[model samples]
Target: MHYLFWCKDNNTSTPQDMCWVSLRMREQHFPGHVLCWVSMRMRDHLFPSPWQRHDALRAEVGAQAGAADTARETSTALYPLIVRQGMDKYKVLEEWRAGSFGATCIVKEAVGDGRRFAVKKVECIDEHEANLALKEAMVLLNLQHPNICAYKEFFITWDNTISSLFLSLVMDVSDQGDLGGIVRLKRQLVKKMDETVIQMLLGQAIDVLVYIHKQKVLHRNLKPSNILLKDEDSFLLSDFVVETLAADEMKLKIRMDDECKLWMAPEALQFSYSEKSDVWSLGCVLLDMMTCSITNDAEVAALLQEIRLDPVCLENVLKTLVGKVGYSADLCQVLLQMLQIHPVQRATAIELMDVPYVKECLILVGSPLSGVKKTLPPGVSDELYEGGIEKALEFMQIYTDFEDAQISALRHLSWYIADQDGWLCIEEIIRLVVQAMKLHSDSLDIQLEGIWILRDLVSQALAHGLNEECFISNELITTLVRGMRSFLPNTGLLSQICSLMMMLSANEVAAELLGKAGVLQDTLKIMESSLENRELCLSCCGLLWSMAMTESHTRREWLVYAVPVIFNLVLKHLHDGQLVESACCSLWILCLKGCVVEEQTESISWALLESLHAHPQRPVLVKNACLALASLLRTSELAAFRVLVPVSGKNGIALIKEIYHLHSDDPEIVENMCLLFSEMAHYGDTRPEMLSQNMGPFMREIKVKFASTEEIVTLAESTLSKLET
Candidate 1:
């Protein structure tokens, strides 16, 4: 067959120097409009029919003699190349993209099924690079998300003539072309993509990213061309091999062409990336989708370039998008979140999935691993479901088997439960969440998200005068304990587990359930192992306090060992007022439960007194410290003596006096303060210091100010008699 495929290039006038040799290739290679050179009359005279004006003009046998000469002159056909392995073969149909060392081609199976797939042909420097490429391809193959173009197969071939080696990867193809092509098509028509379309597209993009990132894979090179649109409503995130291929193209320099740099995160340019770097690229892609219709491709690229240099200029693009039809303010705001200049400030893939709109988009038009999402009941879809908590719950229920969807649903639900207030059927939400966690027990991310979301739901229940009875079931408790046992010493996972345990420990039955599941054991182990982690320690302390408050699980033999853990937390984080407050509360309850013996007395006294001196103005810390110190003194005369010993320019008596004066307005503090003094007078050493600090006057003030408060008046009168005598 003879063909005349005419194409033009910007810098060269040579007949053979063209974008590509044919139709789709032209679109794939060229970013600008194709130009025709024939004069109007000559063109019309030569070819009257529209078929003659196609991308390639097929010449009948011997009809156009010059066609053979033209083909020989331009030997740029990258297709028609064959890959044979044993009895199987693949025909390369076209080249989709090309760099110095590699090209991604459209390949037809050329047998049996005769289906099409993409074949990335890479020229490796040696077997080492070839091995690395294969390893990366394997990693990408394992990604296996619905919106990620799956890898079909891979094999290696060598060019014996030049002693060069090639790596070919077979991958699934999308129905539509790449996102860059769609954006370009929209630009030509001058029509912006609708928000629902944007949501669906961006939603799938975020979903793919979340899945890959959780697997510890980073799509360091994310651009429109790499995102393959399946059809109008869906797309596959393609080109996981981009960075590897790009590196091989650059001879291992790890550089991107200026065009690709437009979609790159700024930190990525410096070889720094987290999941957030991919976020920056997704942000750039979002901008391209939103602004492509109104602006030319070059203008959009320039805008992306400008944002990399000046991320604040992202607002300029948002301002333009705000004026464009079919774009929502939420879209604009989310775009801003993605484009944050600092990687820390930028939202991650999972974080983006947490956005409710994005989650809805994921359910509606995003790729689903199994089948469709549960349709909202007609009434709910029309009237009640405005992308609220129910849709989030439904998403989890429908895609319960999909780890990615569950992760996204749980994250979105975590925020929705807080933002939209409470779920009308939170009980159902709880059931689904428990089921998700139990199903995805292997996924640390899912477990963390489920536990975190459940904590928030329980917190909301507490805020609205509800109990843990509804939220905390044996299944939930057992699942939590399993999560604890599954991901031990992961301070983040441990911290969240403890937080939820703390909230549920209020109900005696719930507390006993936790105790039975070995939750208290887990808490003690975490507190011991993670004493330096202030946040985890604080959670452990708080959970221990709640357990002691319930009175049912306090006297367990293992409870006594937690006393020192609380003391160490206090010592380690003396400056952290919240940690100190929570720690003191734990010590107070433990002492009240007889868990704190005389052996732990001095450290407990020191932790309580120093916590008071460290955070005198912290009302909760002071009150808890007073209660803890009063407990210690009531139980041990040695503790009473230890408080009187001055440390950090303040003895226990001075610390108590200062706390009393500073928080005299708080009747709880006054009552706890009186308890401290009465316990202090039990030891003669602490008595003089208490009297010297004029404890009598503070007691009189508490008596007058809180005269109607029975506890405060009784404690104050008793303390005044001891101080005066």
Candidate 2:
């Protein structure tokens, strides 16, 4: 076969260069098909006579033909050429650092273009390491994101003298250096970063991870040192070493490298890695950033060392620092999910992006939510409510065909109907909403909307004193419980579900039904999972408080789980007045039922009293704590002594007397105060402490202050009589 090559010149008067090449010679001489043998041969053959006289002209013609052939060959090559400007093109300005792989140096164009770059030189110890370095270069080449370090080019240099090869990767230079340096500098200066800055950096990291994961790559070596700061406001995820996943496998086995163990997930530490492992590393990086801002490098290292000793301690430390660092509740929740010890529970990049805190951060950084927000249809509200039940059903059916529209409409309609009070609780409207929930059982949006609707309906039912049984049935309660379990990790939905459960719990029969349906188990899980979500915790406590009002068996069943969780909540959120009040109220109910264990009684007594001492001005917290203390005392003399012993040092009796004097005009506080003194007077261990204080005038004042209330007057008189005896 014969092939003809044609070339066009900018000068039309110049003849088009044509070359005829034989296929036989082509295959033998150019196995790579990179050079045109005919062009080289023809130039020599045709110009031989004029070569000596026109050496420059002949050389120019050969160069033009070679350039044309190279262009054509490059277009068809299996891999694009590296555009070799050779190692001499870059002048090493400074050695940035040295590592086992090789040295990273600051370099600029040797031609004096003044453009700077980072050149990483990897020494190939063996063929295997060389292949690995080449693979890493390929992985970097495929990545393109603003938050990912940009791969400029790569080249291989051969040294015949040493029989060795070196791979150099050129990347855009980051002016601000790696995140580790920034964190270290900030730590040295004792500079505290705004939560928003931490959030923005985390958001950038997530964005890069999401993009890389979507390309089916795992950044096995994610760490603060691998995150590069492009500028003060920009960060880039760097040094990604790809670990290919088998076609049927979701995880890759990784060798445990001692240097990376600190940031590796539990599973990764065991030589297994997945996208979730990257999330775990990302979480570690986040902690490192936050920790550096608040403390020095030595303390941070010590804290991380402690965490390595006990992985579970990470959660506790994070919880403590979350408050100290003033991180948002949503941000803390995301961090917890990311750091789950079990890889199965750890969040994926996709799920992490959906996290509320992440989304908010993205919005702040001008990355809009993926999809456009759907606007609610006008007149849908009027058609749902005032237009009558049939009109509402007809309007809702229209949205069923469009899921997003349906969810948006349902959410708006539910709130609208809920705002109407009990007037919108007609049978037809209730049935329609229930049917919507059943139809959209698999849709999180619809289910969330259904929860909001049910919440409103139950709230209306409870507020109106309607027969709760008439509105909430066992089947509906079961469905709600299932929804709670399905969306258990969503704190917003969990809060709404807990709110609905609280309303249903107001009814004795409903409360028992919820308990039987494993509502207690689900609520406990929410509490355990959402320790950072104060609203969810408050709602869960309210639900438990209502359930604790049920029969003794049900209350006892709840007390076992509720006590520790509520105790911890009280201890963690001592400054939150509403949370403290709700938690203390639940503890009081448990005590009232005499269901609290000896250990729980002691723990609750100490936590509540400490909280009471911390925030004396919070009237509701104090009242509930006093009532819970009274309940504990009424349970047994041992419980009464336990309550009094801790506060005895600060003149426990004097604090009570002062409380009575401060709020003597308040009926509930006075009543609870009288009850506490009456119980303490009955206990031998506490009676002396009670008598040692200024009790006579305090009792007389209480009795006189509560003269209008029979219960207070009787309790106060009885306490004084006991003192006299």
TM-scores, all models, native as reference? 0.46, 0.46
lDDT by residue (tens digit), candidate 1, 1-725? 22343334546543334322433322223222211211000122344322222112222212222434544565422112122341147777875687433577787877789888877777777645655566466555444455778776666665555556577777888767788887888889998777777787777787778767876788877888888877767788876654455454345354346786787788876666678988888888888888867788678878887886686688877887787555777888889899988887888878776676666676675244223433333343232235767788777777766677777778777877877676456688888888888766677888888887887778778888875566667667767877887798588998888888877776655776665455677788878887878788878888887775543333356778788777777778889888888888777667655577778888788878888888889888777677777767776888878877897976667767766778878777777777777777766666677777777786787789888888777777887777667
* Model 1 weakest lDDT span, ten residues long: 33-42
Stretches off by above 4 angstroms in model 2 are 1-390, 397-405, 418-422, 461-465, 552-555, 646-649
Question: lDDT of all the models against the reference?
Answer: 0.69, 0.64
Flag regions of model 1 displaced more than 4 Å.
1-395, 411-416, 684-709, 723-725
Q: Can you write out model 2's per-residue Cα lDDT over 1-725, one digit (the tens) per residue? A: 12333332324422224333223222223222121111111232344322121233333434444544653554321121222234667788985676433558889988867789888765454433444456445556645455777777666554445655456778777777788887777788777656777887877777777766765778777888878877777788876653421111222223233445667776766557799988988887777777765767666666655654566777776777668766666777888888877778779888877777788776565442323233456665554555533455577777654455566557666656745653345455566566666545456888777777676666666666666657766446656765676676678887887888777776645675676555776787779778888999999998887766553215245567777888888878888888888888888766665557776776777777776766666677777777777767766676666655646365555666666666766787777777777877876666666766767677888778668878778888888887877
